[model samples]
Target: MIDHVYISVTNIDKSLTFYSSALKPLGWKVFGNYDSASGPEGVPDLYGIGDDMYGNGKAVGSSVWLRQRKVGETGLYLGIVCDTNELVDAAYAAAIKAGGTDEGKPADRTYFAHGYYAANVADFDGNRIEFVHKAWNPKRHV
Candidate 1:
């Protein structure tokens, strides 16, 4: 299990808006913010965005941190799970409207498995992000 993941972006504000919009359709929202100066020991300052009260009514700390840095070529790709195919489509649209570059349009990825709906987009800083909806377990939808 991962507690959190952080990525560096050229513009924090732009990346924040991009991510916030992209993930909103999946029921995620920006919930916390952190300043590097105020962050604990080795952690960098970041904008914490995600559904905090996801499981057991306790924060799982599963969030994306947007940190300021110089823009450069990166191979980082972040994958987020969506509960429904509709959410995947909405996320792709939101990402594009939020200034993301469309890498792959929403479609069924039968190679991955049956009912695997997904879309990919590059964030403001060119980080590839994917939204996927797998119909493996219907009970997991939230």
Candidate 2:
């Protein structure tokens, strides 16, 4: 399992506003923030956002951190899982309202398999964000 993930952004405040709005529909909220001086050795400062109810018994749940982008740094893509297709659509709209560029509108990606619904958007920093809902049945797959 992934513990956490971080992405570099050109502007922290702008990115925060973008993410807070874009991810709200998916049940994520801004939870924490850290400065470069307070970060662990060799780690950059970041703004943390994620689902509060996740990883209840563990040290931490899945989270995405937005850090200040360094010179010549490249961006990264992220995929967030949604519980339902409606959430995917909502997230996509929210992202666009938050100043994100639409990569692909919400639709079924049959190539991935049946019941695969997703939407793609590019954040202000041009990082790709995908909201996906996959109706997977473990018993059936097995």
Candidate 3:
């Protein structure tokens, strides 16, 4: 269970637009915005991590506000726990239509074999977020 996940981004408004459009269908609403300095420099921290990680990049139609990291950070997957696979697909589709680039398309994943379906999408910032449902099998050692 993740309380929140944070990343640096370049643009704020475009990120909000793509997320607002893509996340709407998945029943995830932007509960609030974090505009304070404690929040990330460009965009405020967003709530509703349980929704498809469909809109976790910089805002679209804007410049890449942050410098690209040479080595990508491999953080825990921000899983959305959708009610069904259809919701996952819908969120992914909507995100792409709203200016998100495909990190990966919707599909059944083997790792989360217990009925997990998910897809990965990038915001304008190039951060990777995944839309997932029923797809987690964490081992104790892991």
Candidate 4:
């Protein structure tokens, strides 16, 4: 399993707001943040959130970190797992409400699998992300 993922963002504050609000339903929280001074020289400011332990006011590197991007830089695509179809819809609605563009509405993505329910959205800077719940044979939801 992946330990963490970091993505470039145009604005730290805006990205933090968007991510913290949008991913709340998935049990993610803003565990830590740091200005450039918190790192080695020339490091950009960062904001992090995820489903991991938060102690000593730092994220412990088990989260998604948003950092300042280079001029004219772009983004990353992430597909997150969900437990149910309703969560896919909730996350989509929350993302849209937080100013994310609708890449795709929540629905069964038969194009991928028999019961691949998912929703897609893009962050303010076009980082495409999807929340999915795949219902498989024997009705397993993962």
Candidate 5:
């Protein structure tokens, strides 16, 4: 029921480094890129950038990208589904090491109650990404 999600970033290189490493364990990969494209027309416009968003003679500014199909975005969460809470914790730790600012430490949400461990990580643009495990919160309405 969803097509794609777009996020704005201040630094594509840094965002790339952080996301590439962080999302890898979750099975996401950079499926498309427009760093070599010419102008706004070459990039997706829904992300909200001007004609120079990519900048002239340099591909260092905003960019148009796509991630391989996985989960859907609900409201404010990224909705990651992991095999276990332990993996969630590991991913959270990896995100912190990959230049992503930690938004929350791993914890159990008894409301969901299985092993639901989740943590928030901020991208270079301050976009919040979440790492989650359903079992951590069995009462989380699974």
Candidate 6:
């Protein structure tokens, strides 16, 4: 239902490096890039990192773009699915190593549903992201 999500970052270069390593375990990568001059009139430079099944890297299939942060915008929250509880831990570990702040540790989140294992971490720009593995979700993605 969603094409892409644009994340405004205080620094794209730093975010790119951080995310490239952080999301690798979940099968995401920086597949596209464009400079500020390459965008429409006033758009800042964008870096694409996510599951790029659609090939655009800026749209289609989990396209996540990181651009220059705008004033007065702190951040947003996002959830990323993991294939296993182990992957959830791995993602959390990687995120922390990549400079993410620990929001919560990996553990079973029965408060949400049975078999929901997850971890929470804040990105460079303070975006709270959850890495989750939920057996309660569709079988294909879990």
Question: Whose lDDT is greatest here?
Answer: 2
lDDT computed for candidate 6: 0.72
If candidate 3 were superposed on the true structure by all CA atoms, what would the RMSD be? Answer: 14.2
TM-scores for every predicted model: 0.48, 0.47, 0.43, 0.46, 0.39, 0.47
Across 20-121, the per-residue lDDT of candidate 2 in tens digits comes to: 899889888998786656432644677888865443433234677898888998867576777678988999999999999998899987654477688889
List the pairs of residues colliding in candidate 2. none
lDDT by residue for model 5 (1-142), tens: 1112345455656666676666566545554453423332322222222223122323222222432222453222244545466877898888889998877777774433344456667777756666665542222223
Compose the digit string of candidate 3's lDDT tens values, residues 13-62: 55656665665786555545433445324332343322433233221111
Q: After superposition, how far is residue 120 of candidate 3 from its true place, in Å?
A: 0.6
Total residue pair clashes for candidate 3: 7
**By TM-score, who's the top model here?**
1
Q: What is the C-alpha local distance difference test score of each model?
A: 0.70, 0.74, 0.51, 0.70, 0.49, 0.72
Model 2: residue 14 alpha-carbon error in angstroms: 0.7
Candidate 4 structure quality by residue, lDDT tens digits, 26-140? 7789977756663445445767787743232232223687988888867775767666799789989999999999888998866444776888888977787888765641222
Question: Tens-digit lDDT track for model 6 on 1-142?
Answer: 2334668888878989998888888788888776666333644577888674534323325657888878887777566767678988999999999999998899986654468687888887778887877664443331
Off by over 4 Å in 4: 1-73, 137-142
Alpha carbon lDDT of residue 30, candidate 2? 93
Per-residue lDDT for 1-142 in model 1, tens only? 2324567788888999999999898777887676656432533576878664443233333567787764464556576767778988998999999999988899987654477688889987767788877666343423
